[model samples]
Structure formats: C-alpha cells, structure tokens
Target: MKKIYCLIYILFTLPLLSQEKEGITHSGQLTGNPPFPIENYSELDNPKSTSETLWNKKNRTFVSWANTDVRYNKEIPAPIALSQETLHLSAWKGEQLNAQLIISAHRKSLELNFEISDLSSSQSKIESKNITGGFVRYVMTDELNKDGKGACGPRNHKEFDSTLVADPIDHLNDRLSIAKNTTRPVWVTINVPRDITKGKYTGEIKIRDGDRILKKLGLEIEVLDRVLPKSENWKFHLDLWQNPYAAARYYRTDLWSDEHFAAMKQDLQHYVNAGGKSITASIMNRPWNGQTYDPFQSMVTWRKTIDNKWSFDFTVFDKWVEFMMDLGVKKQINCYSMVPWRLAFEYFDEASNSMKTIETKPGEKAYSEMWGAMLKAFATHLKKKGWFGKTYISMDERPMDVMLETIKLIKSADKNFKISFAGSFHKELLERIDDYCLALGENYPQEILGKRQNRGKISTFYTSCAHPRPNSFTFSPPAETAWYGWYAAATGLDGYLRWAYASWPLEPLLDSRFSTWAAGDTYLVYPGGRTSIRFQKLLEGIQAYEKIKLLRREFIESGEKEDLKKLDTLLNGFASSEIIEKDVAQSIKKANIQLNSF
Candidate 1:
C-alpha cells in the first residue's frame, strides 16, 4: 500500500499557516474513521530547524473520544471533533477512568512535558497523584479481514495479513522521541480514591513544549456518593488463560526458574489489577497442540514405574498454584484438558527407560486407564493441598462426542471433580459443567441461567477470531472493550472469558502478528506488564459492570422504580446483536448520561 495525501485538505489550510501560535495541534488516528480534521499547520510554523519539518503539515483534531488506531505514514482518522474545552468526567469512589492527549510532531520533532494539578472540593481535595499519565507508543499490528472460523491452525492464513498495518496504543512510556510528521499520544488516567468526598473536584492538565505550554485542557471530576468496590471484591469471573511458556521464552529464562516467575509476575500484575479470578493450569504437554508461538508444557509431569503403576509429580503444579494464589487470582484453578485438540498423550516409560507418547481416544481402554490414574492422583494431591474444591478440569472448543466421553471419564474417576467448558452451548451438559462460557453470538438460555445460579455455577461468554466487532483485536476500536460490559449487562451474564492473556508472540510489544490467530489476538496486555489501550478499556468495561451492578442493587433497595426501569430499558438495547454492528461509543455515552443523572 502507498501513503495517500489529502490534496484538497492541504489546499484549504495552506493560506491559514500563521494561526498556529494561537494553539497547539498534531495528527494521527487512522482510515475507516470519519475525516474531520479541524486544525492544520504549514512549514511557516517551523522555529526549530534542529528537527525535521515538512513544507505541508498533516491535520489534527481535538476529539471528545478516541476509539481508533493512531497510525504513522497512514491517513489520519477523523475524530469526534471538539474545540479545546473542559473534559467533564464522573466516577464512583475507587473507579479509574482513562483518556488520551495526542500531540503529533506535525511541523517538526518536539519535546513535551506534562503536569496535572490537584483538584479541590469544598469538603476535601484530590491530590495530583490521583491524576497520572504517560506518553503512548505505537506498535505494529496485523489485521484480519475475516474470522478464519476460529481454527487452531498454522500461520499464513489467506484471510489475514502477515504484514503490520495498524499501530494501536500498545505501550505506555514516560518519554518519547518523535520524528517528523509522526504523532505521539499521552495516556491520561484519573484514579478516584475510595475515601474521596462526594463532591465535584476541579483540575487541569498542562502539556508543555520546551518552556512554553503547548496545550491545557480543563478536568472536572464528579466523585459520586457511591463507591465501586476494589478489584479484589469484584464478582466478575474474568478468566484469561496464562501461558507461562511465553513468559519464559520472552525473558530467556529457564522454565519455572526464579527469574521466570519474576518476569511472569510483572505481567500477571496487570491481570490481577483487572479483577482476575482464575489461574490457568495445564495438566498435559502442549495442551492446545502448539496453536500459540510458545508451547504450553504441563505443570504435572507423568511417570510410570517398571511395575506398570502410574505416578504424578506435582512440584511444578504446586509452585504454579501457589504463585498465582499469592498474586491474588485465587478463586479458581482451571486445569486444561481431559481432552486436548489431539488425543496423543505422553509419559515416562520406566520399562523402556525413555520418554514415550501414546495416541488414544477418551472411551478406549488405553485412554481411560491413563487418564483415570492421573485424575485419581490429581484429586488426592488437590485434596492434600486444599485445592480440591476450586480445581476444574477445563476443555476448549471440542466436539460433542469428545466432550461427552471426556466428561464421563472425569465423573467415573471422581464425581467430586469440577469441570469448566468454553465452546458452543450444549443443553445436555448444562447440569454437568460448573463453569460454562458460551462464545459470542451463541445465546445461553436465560431461564436455565437461574438454575445454574442457584446451583452456584458460572455462565459467561467469550469471543475469538469468529467475532469481529466489539472484540479486542489490536485494530479494533478502543471503546469495544467497554462495550463488552454493556453486552454482559444486556444478557445478564456473570463475566467474560478470553483464551489468551499473555500468550505473547515472538515480538508482542513491536509486532503483534502471530502466524496462527489474528494479529494481537493472542494477548491483551503487553510484555513487561504494560497495559494497552484495549486492556485499559477492558478494565473500564469491568468497572462499568461493577458500577452498573451496584447501581441496580441500590435502586432496588431504595424503590427507585422509574430510574431502575429506565436503566434496564437502556441496557435492553444491547440485547440485540445489532448494537455491536453500530458505533458503540455513541450508545455507551448516551447511556452514561442517564446513569450519571441518578
């Protein structure tokens, strides 16, 4: 592809080149976005010949919300153009909200500094520490034109591009080195303290260039009388499968070494902060048959004695479980695969004195004998460690026959063992599975959900290469993550599930294209525990869920039927799949207006 210039736009703004001294502007964002450039500058603005400058500068706009990718060497995206003015925000105590302040080096490379002031209310004040920000860095990303049917296949899919086309907000930095005609974005975060007084607090964010202020936007936060419980207290059953192998590979550390755990901790902190409630554990090698760049090795090692007796080693498994528990993802431990993509199982052959692999199906004698011995031992170990109740034997998108055989095998071994499933809805297994997650667009029977709730079972939903809009694809709109909460509310689901969390590619922070799945599809947060715009917005969505949950309960307690009914009606619109097909940010914003009014 070639860089396309806005010839007519340049012609219209060339005469007004001298007005730049009045305000600061830059360009970024992407195509497929509305073209609403409100500010333009020319080379006449070049006071710094020290850096590269263009004869014609790209256009930039002041936007009310940023939901598109910010691209360099690509056409700028049209923003919901707004004049520089106060950005009003509302949040409950302990809630975190995010926004962007973009400053591209339109005329020349520039240096930028940031300062956020302390906001004051009549009863109290919010410290400057509550408001924090960092420069947003661009990372390369591939795009998927189609869903690819959610296949666990190799790379080089014709429907997806191997080349990087989009650069979404994937990194946060304290400093940036911008080049000519390129852009840099500042990610601003406002963390309302749980104990802050219920009143309006006022402040401003000042962006400086050299010694002079480049731009200043007023920040007014309305701290609600209500409080959003801490992430630890959240009820959302967020399950993002972790890949320890990826962390070990990314950091060049030995598997399960101290260095590896340290490196993994950095990334898992991002997960814990999002109110993560589950830990992914693989009981067999290559659980998904190498779908990801990294191979997921089983924590429990299988061994056989010369006498033909089976034994299991829980050293790695125990360490992993304790590690995640220590980090606060202690609610559930999801063990992968009574049935993997492939039926090949591996074990140490004591008689042969070598490692061996066996191919077997669930019902056959070989498969049952091997898995039965392991589960018997696994249950005993879990009971000894006090993890028996929370541990679940989890399976992915397998066929109905396979699932039935596998579930039978599990129960025959020990009916007390729990099971977690993520796939198409099967009414036959609804009473059997403990934690059931349906895929996007796959409806779960609303009436059945009540029975599951009564029985203390979980019913959530997920998205993969199959769902396009309202997904966390790197090129997807940032608001889509938040739209997820609205979807959950509309459907009355517990939470969301994603197959990959930190299943990093060869180079995640730079190029997010993987050979198998969609680009950036294998991960949410970046390496080194950095949070992306998508991940941040995902937290935003979870927070939105928590807030909405609390508000609904409050309304019910206070008998505010009108407000509660209006809120329910607003959420009902999301029940239709058509909401994601449209611009969700507009819908969410309108809904928020009514929510804040009460």
Candidate 2:
C-alpha cells in the first residue's frame, strides 16, 4: 500500500519539478523581456498536469551536453548523464552552421549565463561576431494534433506533448533561470567565411553563471577542402513561403511601417542565410482563404476603371520584391497564386468605390476575363522591373480540371509567362508548367524530370498537412528536418518547399499551436529574428544537400568512379519512404557518418 502511494507521488511530482518558469510567458522578445502584449495564453501552460515520461529517477542538479537533434522537454529529467561532449562539425565555406548544448539543473533552480570563444584555424580566425550564442526557449504544446486530413501517432515526441517544449533559440545576453530538474539548451551558431582558409578549426563554448564557469565543451570543425558556393549561388532551390503581415501583427507595428520592415528584415535575413531562393509574393487577396493567421493580402491592387480598362498598383509588389532581392533572395519571385483554393476574386470596383469579391470558379467566362487582364498587366509590370525572366506565377493545391483552364488562361494572357504549382501530382499540366512541386511520396517520372532538367525547368517536392513524417511540424523529430535534404537528393529533386515560414500565431514566442495543424507547423523561427532548433537542423540537411552536389560534381570531373558510386549509394538509401521513426533515425545517422568521412 505504501509503495503504491509513493509511486503515484513520484509520477505526479516529476513533471511539476521541471517547469520553474512553467506558466511564465511574458518574455517574447529576443531581448528576453516581454514575449508579447498577452502575458499568458492559458494554454501556454497545461491546464491539466501531463506526464512527460512513464518513469524516472531522482538525481542531483547537474549540467550536460546534448546534440541539436535531441529535443529535451522541461517536464522530464535529462535523459542522459553526459556532463560534457565534443561538438564535431563540418561546413563548406560561406555556409552558416549551428549546434546545440544542454545544461541540466536536476531538482534545483539556477540562474545562468553563457559565452562562446572564437574559432581559430592555424591559418585564420573567426571572430566572436561571426559566432553567436543563444539559449533555447520553451513553448507549450498543449495538444497533439490529429490533423483533419490525416496524421500518424501523436506518440512520445515531446514537441507533441502537452507540456513545456523547448524550441525557440533565444537571443543571448539576458540571464535566465532554469526550473528545478529542468533542462536549458544553449545554441551556438557559426558563420564560416567564404574566403577563409580550408583546414581544421577549434573553439570552446563556455557555460557560466556570471563569472564562474560551469562547463566548457570542445568544438571542432573541419572546413572541407571543397568550397561551397555562396547561398546566392547555390543551385538547390529553397522556397519557404513568407507572410509579412504576421511580423507586423506580432511586433505591434503598423503594416509596411519602417518598424515593420526593420522587424521583418531580421527574420528574412535568416531565411536568406538558409539559402531561400524564392520570394513568396501574393498576387490575389486571401490566396488560400484565410489559411493563415494573417491575411496574405494581394500585393498588387487590381482595379477596373470606369472606362473599363484594367490598371494595377504595383507599389506594394515592387517594394516587396525589391526588398527581398536587395536582401539576397534574387533567384525567383514565386507569386502565389492564380488558382486559389476558393475562386473568390477580389478587386477594387471603380463603380462601387469599394473593394469587392467576386465568387467565380475557373473555366467560367467571368474568371477568364478577370484573371486575363490581371496577368497581362502583371507581366508588363514585371518586365518593367527586369523581373519577368525570374518571376513564376505560382499556385498551391488546386484541382487538375481547374489547372487546365487556368494554364490556358495564363498562356493566353502572356505566352512567356512561367507557371508554378505545388500540390498533388499533375501529369497533364507537366508540359505547360515551368516549376512543378509534388507532395512527398509522390514521384515525378524519370522521363519527365529528364526533359525538365534539359529545359532548365525545376522539379521539386513539398510536405504539407498530408505528409505524416519527414515534415517540419514543430513536434516532428529533428532527424526529419535533415531527412528532407537527403530525400531530395536521393530522388534527384531540384529543391524543396515549406509554405509556412512565418505564419505565426498571436504570440508565437509563447505558443506554437493552432486549431487545425500540429504545434510549430504555422512557423519555423520565432519573432525578433530568432531561429528555432527545427530551423537549425533544417540547415544541417540543406548543407548536406550542397555538399553532396559539390562532391558528386567533383567526383565526376576527377573521374573518381569508386567514390562516386559510394556517394550515390548513400543517397539512394534515403530514397525510401522515410515516414517511419526508427528507419529515418537510422538512415540519418548512417548518412551523417558516411558524409563526414567523404
């Protein structure tokens, strides 16, 4: 009888012991002050006590080291007893690399600060400015989503648990307190210079409380002999759809204000750093009918004059594209979308003196005339800005029957116009579309990809609500993020796309859940330009893609058939349906081991 009571007590007390700052959501800024105006989202802290683990053991307060792939929740005891571990890494020149370390305070609260030393290669040194540190912040994942479309288990992943899940990598500087028996993660980011000498680099990440040192982890990296092209030059296309309105709303600034642009620039710079290749500009209002928290208002205002002529205000569209290009995402402007989920066309009515929405579907005369004029005008404006060559008229998940008519309408508007679509496989529209994206698990026929490759067209895949694994959902395993790059390479894809870049919730820093999607599905990075662990791990995968591309080319040019076969085999291993947890975890592990050897 006594044993049973003791067991029950331990079960209930373990989770409570870890969240010292459990209910506190005030600090949202990277400054570590207020997270947002709403001090608390009742759901930020679970209303009901939830179990982090089935069983655990009590231990003394201690610090430890953990890899970036590991997601340590605040509600459970640190899984490992590792007090220190070396951060072994490799990067191509001009690439930004990141790693994570854990500081566990078991059954004891702690106020901690941190610092990172400069990385030096015997030849040259990387300054502290290039290497930055941040502490990972925790947000509540109150419920595991069973997405309406479909999803696998809401199983044991902490990001899916209804507890305090550490995710956002906060801006370093402010001292933070760790809850008793909880873990705090310190993130170290390194920006390798393009011109730096190629060799070994070593550094130390010092964990401290004020002037006292708690631990120092050894950091080592081999700047590979091969130089990776700068982000702007990388061929692996990355398109993370952007939502500018959310930044303004979360930061409490006026839309398009100087403050808003300043706030947005920070996050956008991070995107560019990750090799973002496309500018996601909306051409039609509510492109997906309020799928996001903020309205993706039409960048170009469409109006029918009293004289029955069509005119467009490209002021917003031009400013956005120019701003993004100036920031280095200059490859393609993917303007979404011509075939919106709902065929509700919004335009300024000169006769009514108001914005009006016309409900019309594709193939209808009204729809044809309305879009035809807009596309023609849009083409003219794009040509004026010298953007016509790189601009793609993009759409997301509309039916094939509709696509045929829309494609016909688009080509009729302007023969040179390029069209992009990301959704289910569409064989009929293949010849007509320039940039094509299919959902994960959907393969593009070899012959189709071959032809497109010769034509300088792009063939890629995307993961959205339907894909159960290898997805970027907040609670997804960190290994899944890296899997995207490996999978793309294995399948001979040009690149990948994640539509949710910053479709943030009310207080993104505090909560990452939504009514319909899994936690963290709505956004990747937090406000104030802070990147999440998920985002950093994603960088790990993309860097892998670039490395593979570089190595494959070098091997072929140098006639290294043996190495080429080895590389090809490794990538081919990732070609499997990587939706299973154990298989993906093992594949990522195996690929990383073999990649570093090369």
Candidate 3:
C-alpha cells in the first residue's frame, strides 16, 4: 500500500516537473526560458479580456490587457489606444490572408521589432514567400458628414462632404515612434502558396525591444489541399481608376520618365496584385477635371500636315499600350471619357505648334466635327492594335443625353464599338450600354438589370462621395469594404468600380482628406509605398467573392441545390445588412466548410 502511494506521488510530481521544464509554472504563467524578466502579459482574442488563455491552444492568441474603453468621440478625432488583443491569421493554399493588431504605448514612445519562427518540420515548411513582414499600414478615419448628399444622382457633379475639419489622423507606426499612451494598428499578411502541402503549421512572432523579448505571439496556419485560382478567375469586373499622372505629381517628375514610370509601375502593380482587373486609359486630356490629379494629356496626338492633311502620332499612345500589356492588363483596357467632365477635349496641334481645346457646348459645330474625327481615329487605332474586343469607351457621371450622344458618335465611327459608363441607372439606357456601372441607390428595375446581365452585359455598381456606405475608404470599417465582393455575388452584379486608385491629395500618405471631395476620396493607395487597409479589405472581399463563386460552381456540378441555397441565404442576409468583419469571415468559413464536405 505504501509502494502504491509512492507510485501515485511520482506520477503526479513527474508531470509537474515536465511542466516546469517547459517553462509553465504552477500559477499558469508561460515564462518560457528567456534571459530577461517577462511578466504582466496576458492573451486575449479582443482587448476587453477578463482572463488569460481565452481560447484553446490550437487557436490564435491575441495578447492584450485590461484598459479603459477607447472611443472615437468628437473631442478627439484621432485617438489611439492599445489593441485589446493580438492578431490571428488563417489562410488556405494559394490564398493571402492578413490581420491587424493594435499596439499601445502607455508610458512613453516605444519601437518594437518583430520576427517569426520557422513554421516547419523535418519534412515540410512554409516557404519564405508564404511568410513576410514590414507590410504594415496605418489606419486612419474621418467623421462622416451627416448633412452631405446621400447618393450620387443624375449628373451630380457637386462634391460629397466628409466633414473632416481636423488634421488627418493615423495610428502610430511600427517603424516610427509610438507616442505615449497611444494606440496604433500593425498589419501582417500571409500568403499560402498554391502548391503547399496540407497540414497545420505553427510558429511564434516575437516582439522585441533590442535584445529583450517583449512578447512572443503565437501563429498558426492551416494549409488545405484546396487551391485558390488566380485573380483573373474572379468573375467580378473590378475597375479602380488609375492615375499615372498622380504618380508624376506626387513624385515631382515628368510623365513617362524613368522616375515617373517606376513610381507608376509600383502603383499599378499594387493595384493588379490586389485584384484590380480593369485598367483606366486616358485617350484625351483631363478626362475628369476638378478631380484629384492634374489634367492628364491625351495619349494620342494629332497634327495637321504642312499640306493641310490630318495625321496622327501614335508614339506616346503605343508606349502606354505596351506598358499596360507588360503589366498584364489584358483583361479590360477601359478608355476614359467619350464625353469627359464639362464636355471638353484638348489636344496638341503640331501644325499650329500649340495645344488647342474643343468644347462641346450644345450645337457646337467645331466641337462635333473635331470629336467625330477623333473618335473615328481612336476606333481605327484600337482595331488595328487588337484592343477593340477588350476595350470599352468609358464615361463618368454624365447626363443621359450626353451619354447617348457620345455613344452615337462612337458607334458611327465604329459600329462594333463597346461603350461603358458610370451613371445613374436609366431603364432606357440599360440595353444601350455594354457595361453600365450604376450608383447603388439609383431607382433601377431589377428585371432590367437581370435581363441586361443575362444578355452578356456587364452590370456593375460604383460608390464615391455621395454613396458613402459600403465604401472602400478610411472612414468606413474594413469589413464593409470586404462586403462589396459578397454584395456583388448576392446581387448578381458583374463587379464594382471606384473612381480613383492613386489620385493623391497634396500629402496623401499623411492625409487622405480632399477639399473638393470626401476625405479618403482622392485615392485608395498611398503615394510612395504600401497599400491602405481599405485596399486590403477590398482584396479580401474579392477573395471571398471568388471563393463563393467556386463553391457555387462545385455545388451546381454536384447537384447540391440544398447546399447552394444555404450559401445563397447566408450571402443575401450579409448583403442586406451593414456587414461586420466577423460576419463576413464567418460566412466565408461556413461556405468553405460546406464546400469541403462535398
């Protein structure tokens, strides 16, 4: 009996000894064998945690401590607080996932360096491409203008107010100093390669201040056998208007120069990597005036010969096309402005050795003739360059009469021309356009939209200053940006379009506010480097949409109408509400779960 008692004591003590060896204390503290003194650290899924170890070991642990609630009130436009929890990220094979963690510095300014452990075993490990850092971005916000116009109406050229009167707000940066008692968001992205092996990979992200380990956050990625297709397979026709001229202005360089080209290439590559499909091409000067960037010159130039014959110079235009093609913008080259802002066109006149303008005030004979000839020349060039089929003559926020007139002129030039417009949804205009990007709140007959979509017409919706909800801007929540994709799937729309991609303010990275438009209106991306949180959220939304599309296809192939109905129900419900990030993630998770079961 004494011997048996000794055995029981040994068994219990042995386990305790093992726990101690692993740096786990009887008080449940993880004092993992580090040189420095580490204490007062707790893990939470959110900032408002009452206890440590809020989840299972397999789950991600967000580290945070109890603190006073940080609110965004009127007194403080940009208040910073510590993140309530650490960040957790999960991704499938061939998918990229990102998460933001809030870090607060309470006493004084602090700088923290972070490194991740190798998530590998003897057989397999996550590739360097699969794990990367320094992709951090700051989160900024502005007060919503309550008195602003609600939705963009017909020919509504007026600006939508964001009411951002204060200086621009941004979370403290990781590379830069974090102010005392200030909070900031740090973003980390993980890309699971398409050919990665299936299994659970575990690692730790250690936050350090010099030689001291401030915190060791855990990371886990579950790589499945499933492969996410390329961004091109995402059926949505996403068009974020590009501003190469913005690149030049921001960088203080001449257009198409080595410096300007490099900057523009960076911005364009960022857009394409984030699932932007439609490329905006300027065929005339100042396609949309009074906008973010300066009036861009027409890529195509025309000259009258010494003998009074008309000639075209395709040098600059050809270079632009080649550059776009090199960047893999073969999906859709959307030519800006068959009828641009204020119905004006400008061109360089080599014969006169000067630049000239043609204004299309009603019944302006010179304007009509000049525009007609220009359209004819553009159509012929597009056809000869093999860009006609993938090209669309685009206009923005113009009146019905103007759009119709522009379409007529283009069609007369080339009968097979495809026209794309972002205007108020007009029933009569639905059948006339190959691509109609309507505002969200426009009174449109669903039957017409459905019918147009059925006939292979590309139907999309756009949001700007007027239609602020469900927007990809700093003021809006990241989840709302992601919901655009799910919303498109539910509504049976082809895709989404935002007016600006790189239209920067005077100091875009510092402040996204614009004088004429809403804050964060001029651009989705910053000037010199890195993408915005809104942009990343947009990518997530696109990924979610693509996942849903693939699952729906599988369900159809497998004849699982019930599963398909369930997914549709979830998506429709999400679409109808002011969606949160959790709901979007849950919906995607549930849909994937259902898909995997098949």
Candidate 4:
C-alpha cells in the first residue's frame, strides 16, 4: 500500500512542476519582476573605473556615451573613450523632458541592466510614478563597398546612407545587444506632471551585468514653475500623413480588424500627444499615387447605375470619422484628391450587379463627370456630419492647369468648398487655394504668406527627397528637427507638413531604405509599435517653438518692448544658421532665464 501511494503522489505533482517550469502554473498570472529593476539612483559612477574589462579596446567592445542637447551624425559609431558622465536636463511643468544616452560598442556584445532611484532630497521627493524608462534601437552606418552597395541598399546620398542590419533587440523593452563594436542610442523621457513641485530634482542611473554594476550615471532635472499649457494653441500647424492601410499590411491584419484599429489608435494618440493638430483622411481610392504597398482604403465607396448616376456608401466613412473625433483630430480633416494622379478608380455598377473600372486622363469628360459627382456627395456628407467647416478638398503635387481644372470641378459641386493643395510655387493660384503646402526651398511671395497668415490658412512647407538639410532622420542631427519650429517662427510661416509619417518600407523596423526616396524619407516612426529617436527630437523642437511663443506673448503682454525685441533677434539669428541645433537650446535657455527674471 505504501508503494502504490508513493507512485500516485509522484504522478500528481509532476504535471504541476512542469507547468511552473514553463511559466504557466496559473493562467494569466505573471512570474515575477524582470531580470533587473528599473528605478532612479542617487549616484553616478563607472563600476570598472581602472579595469578595461567593461569594454575591450582591442576587440572593439569599448563603449562611449554622452547626453547632448541635440543629436547630429548620431548614426556614426563613437570612439572608444568615455565621453560624458552625467545627464543634465530641464523642462517646465506639464512637459515631457527628453534626454538620450548614446552607447557605442565595438566588436563585442554586452548585456546591460538599468535602474533609477526616485529623485528626492530633504525638502521634496518625486516618486518613480512620474518617471518612465524606454529605449529605441539605433542603426549604425556601415562601410560601403566600392560599388556603393550596403546592407540597406545602394548609397544614393552620402549623408543619409546606413549600413547597420536591422535587429529586433535594438527596439525598446527588449534585451539590448551591440553587434561587434557598433553604437546604439537609448532614449529616456521624464514626463513632469503639472502638479509636481517645481524645483531641481537629482538622481542616478545604474547599469549593470547581473550583480556586477557597470556604470552609475547622474541625472539632474530642473522643473520650472511656469506650466506649458496642453491646449492646442500652437502657432505651427503640422500634418504628418497617417497611413492606416500600410500599418495593417505591415502587421498582417484585415483593415477592419480590432488589432489594426487598436494599433492605429495608439499611433494617432502618440502623434496628437506630441502637438500634431491636422488629420489626413482619404476620400477616394488612394493618396500619393499609390506610392505605398496597399491601396489607401477609402472611407467612402461608390456605386453606379446603368444611367451613369452615382450613389455612395458611408459605413466605413462614419466609423473613421467617429474614431478620429474620439482621438481629438477635429482641427482639420484633409480629404485627398478630387483628381488623384492617373485618375484611375473602380466602382460598383448597381444596374449590372458587377464592379466596373475607369481610367481617364486629366480633363476627360468621364473624369470630370465622375469627380464632380463624388465631390458633390462628399461636400453634402461633410455638411451632414458637421465637418464641412474644417474639411479641405485636397490635391497633391499636380500641374497648375490640372489643379485649376480640379478646383473648377469642385466648385461646380459646391461653390463654398475649401480647397487645399501641396504643389509647386504658383503665384497665380495663391488666392484660389485655401491651404498651400509648398516645398521648403520654394520662394513664398510675401503677399501669399501674409494673406495666409492673416486669414489663418495653412501656409506650410514640406520636405522629402528634394532637400537634405534640416531633415528628420537617424543620420541627421537632432537640431535639424528643432529648427523646423524655430524656422517657422522666424519666417512667419503658420505650419509644417511631411508627406509620410508611417509609410513603412519592406523591413521598416530594421531598415528604412526605399527604392526611390532617401532611406528615412518614407517614414518618421517605426512599425511593430516603436517610436524613433528622430520622432522624439521632432517633439523637442516643437516644444521649443512653443516655449519661444509663450515667452514672446508674455513679453508683449507685459509691455516689455526691449525683451520682446531681444527674443525676436535671438530667433532671427538662430534661423539664419545652416546648423542651428548646437546653439538653439542654449539661446532658448538664456531667453527663458531673461523672461523669468522679468
């Protein structure tokens, strides 16, 4: 009997042991804390002060890191020397403060553990709740072969080419690994709540390997009493085109799937949270000439009868409108092309009970008739949905004559329709166009800029493959992005626009190279739910613009003419520089100090 009882006991407990070992003993319950704790520390020191084992100089495992006000040429690997020792950052209450610690490893792999202690002193303590740690994988530049070929692709532009192979571990919330002497930039964001006590808070960042601590870096954040308002009062209007269809394709989901919708919501929320105000809505088949992988899913579909009469379906349109409104994107709903490039489309024929396709060149009677009906229906729908006032009938980069014809067709449908275009510098079309998105290098006539500024129209400039300087990319310096806002303020432009925000390349997370455009031209943020260092830097620039605007407002309101003049001088001088990242932060800091004193 004892032997039989022993066998049964063993049988019953073995399954439980296996389950525990597999990390599923209890369904839906997590195992424990991660391998290392993420917390703030009070000290910064290198664990291997004298010994060089932490980074092997000969094997190229040596590391170098620093905290900079702006990032420039960050894709290049750093030298094997310790660069900087501490992180000093500043922000106003209700602002997200950003700092980056760029780590370069040469020729060896490393596993690092990180933690931060609560920032505190005898007077006050800011808990870990107000702090969060995350990182983005940085791709390094590779040596191009004699043929100008590399892992990413052929080196089109010398400055924008990258040789780093994409790795999953480079993104945030994953194990970090440096391939044989490469550099990776890890971003740290501290969101200071509005109610937090305004003062200087200090802490340390602990990096280790198992129990052996690698480095402890000091952190100091000075939170000012002045609060940056969360309201959408920004003078700059930015529209980074949101592509949901590409997102679904990249993630391998149906366009209407819950997963796709959830992913889109998260991305849009991030965009709006970073001071983005405008939303891109596709009225027809696709935008940008189907330059993307999948068709730009139209919110509204059309049906045609035997008599050539057209009707519409609004199921998808309604859902998208409700979804965007919930995400606080009511500022501007930009509807793409009454006349898209190539003027091609497919619609259902109700009388024949089959689908029909139509491809017509510009000025074709068929094109005009079809687009006229579509625009009329769209205008009526927008009015019914209460979005007409905020909607723009958008056409992108078309010939001036073609744009005029398109506008004429739109007016035939609804004379009161507001039109928006991103095309060449056409002096004749300025009065007719409601929103003009011109190239950054294009000369904007003062009268045009003045009229748009006075009428609150969106007179913004965009950049793609045409211009290289002041672009938002991994290879470009962080200051390039910040200059967009500063330049806008100095030039008296109302806003800025980029063609694509989430236009994913074949292997976007690992490589951003496209066949036609520059490597980073296709997109700003990465797929698989990751944010890029470039995106963060862009936010920094936008916030910097906001800060300057606030200072100017206060100075003007207080009747401090001298201070206001000083602020103007500072902005104008910074705008004049080809490289503005290095000095913009310091200038803004000095200006803020002077404003605070008053």
Of 1 and 4, the candidate ranking higher by lDDT: 1
| Model 3: per-residue Cα lDDT at residue 79 | 24
Q: Give the candidate order by descending lDDT.
A: 2, 1, 4, 3
lDDT of 2 at 272: 94
TM-score versus the correct structure, for each prediction: 0.86, 0.88, 0.79, 0.81
Instruction: Please give the lDDT score for candidate 2.
Output: 0.75
Q: Which residue pairs clash in candidate 1?
A: 30-77, 155-515
Clashing pairs in 2: 26-35, 27-35, 28-34, 28-35, 107-181
Q: Is candidate 1 or candidate 4 better by TM-score?
A: 1
What are the lDDT scores of the predictions, listed in order? 0.72, 0.75, 0.60, 0.63
lDDT of 4 by residue, 206-263 (tens): 7654465666778887777788777365556888888887777656568867777876
Candidate 3 C-alpha lDDT tens digits along 1-598: 0000111111112233244233332212343442111121111112122222222211221234211111221211122244333334456677887644444444444565566667664457776456655523332234345454332221111223322221121222334444444344445567777777888776767665556666676666767667788765657778888777767765767888777776677668767776667877887776665454355567767665566545666677777777877876668778876666656766656678786666765336665667677777777887889987878888777778877777777777788888888878776677778888877665346787778877888888877776556665566655566667877877777788888877764445433444445456667776545566677767877887777788889889999999888877766665553444445545555654554443
lDDT of 3 at 210: 52
Top model number, TM-score = 2
Candidate 4 deviates by what RMSD?
13.0
Candidate 4 ranges with C-alpha deviation above 4 Å: 1-65, 68-82, 104-109, 121-125, 140-162, 165-174, 178-182, 231-233, 361-363, 574-598
The runs of at least 3 residues in candidate 3 whose Cα sits more than 4 Å from the true structure, single-residue gaps closed, are 1-89, 121-123, 135-141, 146-174, 304-310, 350-352, 361-364, 443-447, 577-598
Q: Distance from true position, residue 443, model 2, in Å?
A: 0.4
* lDDT value for model 4: 0.63
| Model 1 lDDT tens row, 1-598 | 0011222222222232233233211111122211211111111121123323232433442222233223222223223253445777888889887876666455555566678899888889889888777655545555655453342334443444433333334333444445545545667788889998899999888876656676777888898888888899997889988999988866768999999898888789988988999999999988777666677888998999999989999999999999999999989999988787777888999999999998999889999999999999999889999999999999988778889999999998899999999998999989889999988888887889988988999999988876666678776777787778778887889999998898876546555655555567888877656678788888887887887888899889999998899889988867765444355777777877777676
